[model samples]
Structure formats: C-alpha cells, structure tokens
Target: MAQMARSPRQLGTLIQNARLNRDLTQQALASMVGTGQKTVSRIEAGHPGTKLDTLFGILAALDLDLQLGPRNKGEPDLTEIF
Candidate 1:
C-alpha cells in the first residue's frame, strides 16, 4: 500500500512498518546500515534529530526510495540534478 507521510513521525512509522514487514529487527537494520540500534530506535520513535543522510541510508537499506514532486505546474523536482 502507498502510504502518505506528511510528518516525520508518519515517515518514521512507515519505515518501521517496512522494517518489520521485512522481518528485520532494529539491531539487524542498524548493523546493515552501519549505525547503532539506539539510532534505529530513535528513528522509529520519530526523533526530530535524525539526519537526512541517515534517513536516506536507512530507506535505501529497506529497499525504499523517496520522491519529491511539485504540487503545481510551476514547481520543479528539486531532487533532480541539473
């Protein structure tokens, strides 16, 4: 299912769900992502301090990706490179 995450907490929930769905524990995921279990725990708890690189790494590890689209025609996808 495609879940819409409009907040950091919502995104955290989605990531946690994906991890669980893959039968992965926070420790396992942390090991795979070269981070600590506490970091994973904090991430799942929606800690606002989580870094973008860390988030992206975890997402990639979970086989998930992010897409940023514009809400209007004049908006551009900033995620793309020139």
Candidate 2:
C-alpha cells in the first residue's frame, strides 16, 4: 500500500496514520529516532520547520521507506519553481 504525499501536510498525515496503525506512541517513535516527543509531535503537525533528516529518521523508525518515481500526469515541475 503505497501512499502518495503531494504536500508536507499530506506527508505528515501519512506518517501519523502509519504510527498509529503500528500502535506506536509519539514518545516511543521519538526514542527510536533519537528525538524527543515534541519533535515527533511537530512533525506530525506538519511543521514546515521540520528537517528532511528528521522526517527520514521518523520514516525509518516507522519501518517506511522512500521511493522516487515519475510525477503524475499534469503535475507541474517543482524544480522550475524551487
């Protein structure tokens, strides 16, 4: 079941869902990722300030992995915008 995240909020929602589905508490996941509960909470809250490394760490702790693929049809090129 691969989930596509089109935005930071969507990514956070997916992470939160994954965490809850695994029956993992914020503190527990934070511990696994060598972070704090508040950090996990902020990531789950879709805080833009959250670092990419932090997000990856959380994903690793949740047993999730990242994959790169072609953009969906009609998707704008983010490279041009960024």
Task: Tell me the lDDT of model 1 at 62.
Answer: 98
Which candidate number would show the highest lDDT if scored against the true structure?
A: 2
lDDT tens string, model 1, 1-82?
5666656677889999999999999999999999999999989887789988889999999999898754665545434312
Highest-TM-score candidate = 2
Error of 1 at 54 (Å): 0.8
Q: In every candidate, how many clashes are there? A: 0, 0
Give the Cα-based TM-score of candidate 1 against the true structure: 0.80
Model 2 lDDT tens row, 1-82: 8987766677789999999999999999999999899998888877788878988999988989988788877876665433
lDDT of each: 0.85, 0.86
Sequence-dependent TM-score of model 2: 0.83
After superposition, the stretches of candidate 2 with alpha carbons farther than 4 Å from their true spots are: 75-82
lDDT of 2: 0.86
Worst 10 residues of 1 by lDDT: 73-82
